[model samples]
Target: MKTKLVLNFNPEASNLPITHNLIAEYGLLVNILRAEIDEIGGKMVIEVSGDDDSTNKGVEYLKKAGVGVRPFKEGVRRNDEICTHCGVCVSICPTSALILDHETRKVTFVEEKCVACGVCIDACPPRAMEILI
Candidate 1:
């Protein structure tokens, strides 16, 4: 099973090796999509892959560790009517969620890979990419 999680970490929790424990102890594969940390706290968008039981257990463990866990559904929304398909977002997207289709010469958005980092929101020339957290 694959799950996207948005984690909010408090200052105290920031010092913990949470990601390491999620992998080593929980037996899950962790892919960090987006991360931001500061003196006060931080936020991270991570993709975890494991069996159903392990994934659930990992989520439970996160909650127990005082980390705010939220399910990430839609990351970036593409407004077709507004999008020019100029491929502006293709280069800026870290996850390659936005791609330029060679056959059609159009830009394609793969929502499954999107991490909702909000980079495309400002880069889209037509104002097509909207971030929904």
Candidate 2:
């Protein structure tokens, strides 16, 4: 089965030296399917697909490096009220997570398709995209 790992970085860990090593050593092995950072919140969400052992190893490494790691819940959606439907976010989404509903003519986001790249969030003019964690 595929495992999804999400890590939250504390402010101190952001500038810590071991952070780079943890990513370089462990992150390089895993699939690293998706990654996203919340600039405002100073948090990061990373998804990886692998067996339980590898996932555990990665999380252990991150913890040893002083980074906070956690498992993420699925089925998160965006708030339509703040969405402008400008369509700018659609193109920038590498995973095609966000799309314009043809019939509704409104923007829609699929949680599974999102790799948490955060590109759409950056592209969103109104900052409508949110991580439901």
Candidate maximizing TM-score = 1
Candidate 2 per-residue C-alpha lDDT over 1-133 given as tens digits, one digit per residue, 9 for 90 to 100: 4555666666666665443554565553344555444543245555555566756776777787677777766534567788778788877787788788889887777777876655665667788776464
Pairs in clash, predicted candidate 1 = none
lDDT of 1 by residue, 59-87 (tens): 99999999999999887799999998898
> What is the lDDT for 28 in model 1?
98
State in Å the error of residue 94, model 1: 3.4
TM-score of each: 0.85, 0.58
Q: Against the unseen true structure, what C-alpha lDDT does each candidate score?
A: 0.90, 0.64
